[model samples]
Target: MFGLKDLIGLIISCFIILPVVTFIRETGYFIISGLLGAKNPRLTIGSGPRFFKFKFIDIRRYYHVYSWFSFDFIKAKSKFAYISIYAGPILINAAVALVINALLANDFFEDSKTFWNRFIFYVFYFVLFDAIPMKTVNGKPNNGMIIYELLRYGKRIDYNEDPIIPGTTEAEEEYQKEVEKMKEIKWKEVEEEETFYTDKKG
Candidate 1:
């Protein structure tokens, strides 16, 4: 689906995109980690030389603090927080896009196009991909849900929580019990198909 138009837009966007996203990511990590306190965090992106360096945070398991909350609450908070966190990156992108569109359309800032582009590029040099994945990864797969599973079922992982990832023997047994219990409750399906009468009716 990529064509000349897409390629052109990509090239143009690249002029404002690469550094903007990178910077936003790195700056975000630094700001969050700083707020949380202890060791400063640095994030890196792409396959090239490391731009931001990740350091071991000295804080004592602060990231796991959110586990105290319920699964529903955690999920809701994460989603809401993500939007707030990404606001800066979106704004930066919008601003750069507007500037580039204006320059390309009216040729008003022809002389400083290079200057604006360079400024945008350099400003984002500090931002990196690792910074952005902080909330996205939640440090581990189960994250806040793990605590809820433990509290509710007395196990770190619920039976159906992961259909693919196998649980311990006890959890498996518990899951089978849950399944059998659920099976006892009969559910009537909507009888739209009458298999026995269909052929005779025809």
Candidate 2:
């Protein structure tokens, strides 16, 4: 399906269509997350350190295609919360695609009809592809899988709560023990310093 023309169109569309898609999708996350009362909703358009940011809009935008948003789940544990936060982008992108398609059907931009149609196709394709229920190459769950899990389980599934390695509780216990040992040593040093100063004063 991807001929030379299609490949060139995809490359061009990345520059033209991707940023707008990212902006709308990520902004939807922020708006929906806030409306659902998620604490500290943040919208960042790319991973790693932010290359640019909007303090007023609270969006950190980067030059890459990857983007992310997060919030405290304290108040957003409900099914609707999951829908609002996770499905917001998918829904918004769908809406945008529909609007573009409507405009295309009407031949709204006669001079730029080809470009508009291509844009519409790209947007729709992105929405459908992203809505698939699968983990991405980066191992992050897509919106479809997220929503499906929330519906099935009645809450968000936290992968982080799972063990880093299967059947290896001993590693966790050892890590905890090391932390406690460090804390005890620090406390002992503090106590010794306090005793030395008190004795000198006396």
Steric collisions counted per model: 3, 0
Model 2 Cα shift for residue 67 (angstroms): 2.8
How much lDDT does each candidate structure score?
0.39, 0.65
Error of 1 at 15 (Å): 6.4
Best model number under TM-score? 2
For 40-123, candidate 2 gives per-residue lDDT tens digits of 455555543334545423233345565556554436566776666677777888888898778878878888877777777766
lDDT, candidate 2, at 115:
71
Alpha-carbon RMSD to native, per candidate: 17.6, 12.1
Name the TM-score of candidate 2: 0.64
lDDT of 2 at 167: 22
Task: Give the runs in model 2 whose Cα sits over 4 Å from its true position.
Answer: 1-11, 46-52, 56-62, 156-202
